[model samples]
Target: MDKKKTLLTLSAVAIGSVIYNYLKPVKSDVEVIQDFDLQKYLGKWYEIARFDFFWEKNLKNVTAEYSMNEDGSVKVKNEGVNITTEKTKTSIGKAKYAGNVNEGALKVSFFGPFYSGYNIVMIDSDYQDALIFGDNLDYIWILSRTKSINEDRKAHYLKYAKDCGYDLSKLKWTVQEG
Candidate 1:
């Protein structure tokens, strides 16, 4: 009886350890890119992949469009197709540089006056695609101008994210209609 009790306690500890590791946020040293050009970054970006979020549930063919507004803030329009419901969903938001313009840090809000972090940690030259990270490691998205991504680029981003301590098992490869 004592042996069985010991075995059960050990098993519980092991399971708890795994869950704790998964839930704990990755303390990243990853900084947003320097010399960030908000104007150049403004354009349509497809959701190549992302971590699941309630607002984006059942979404496919997701895309985010950015453009400059007269007030020097950015206008954001997010669109996605809900194939499950056979309907299109759209949300409009706005963004402004949260820090220095040279830093790839911005605050975006779809709701009135309430904003959230929208930082671009990794982006290639020519702005073809980018990796968007949130204030914490919980939120992440791989965005590209094109709907499809080459394996090479995808591999690079995956490795980088892993190195930054993200759990790759949680990544959801987004589905988009060509």
Candidate 2:
């Protein structure tokens, strides 16, 4: 009887852990750009700014390639060159629309053993620039197709970032080389 109770308790604990991890809240105050047009947004987006992460640290010439997949999802190919090691790593994933036209979000996952979060927090009217967030606050990125963005556009995004509770000082501008 004691052994059976122990097994049941362990089973309950294991189930609870799985549920906790799966149902973890990853939402932030950042609003999804509702006016996002997938057609315009689909392309090679250069990393303009990002919150530092180990995999992306000291990485340069980073860009995310997006393509439409037959599975009714957007294929994501994130490639970057490690400045320190001069090595390139490419991670492949897929994303689907999760919000409406005006307030749009995306859920992306690598063809992994498990799924992860990839949310779109903000985007420009022309879809020329965007800010993305992931499962945690640590995952933040600003992307643009061009190496440079207009001053006014930058200002607008910065304001949005502030509203989203991001520390402006923590935003590291990606170094683009011509």
Best-fitting candidate, measured by TM-score? 1
Model 2 lDDT per residue over 1-178, tens place: 6999999987887677579666765556555656666778788999998888766788898899999999878898998888888898888888887656444677777644345556677677677887787665556788898988878877877887677666778788888788
lDDT of 2 at 47: 93
RMSD of each: 10.8, 6.2
TM-score of predicted structure 2 = 0.77
Q: What are the clash counts of all predictions, listed in order?
A: 0, 4
lDDT of 1 by residue, 28-81 (tens): 557899999888999999999998887788899999999999999999999998
TM-score of 1: 0.82
Error of 2 at 129 (Å): 1.4
lDDT (Cα atoms) of all candidates against the true structure: 0.87, 0.76
The residue pairs in collision within model 1 are none
Q: How far is candidate 1 from the true structure (C-alpha RMSD, Å)?
A: 10.8
Q: Give lDDT for model 1.
A: 0.87
Cα error, residue 45 of model 2, in Å, equals 0.6
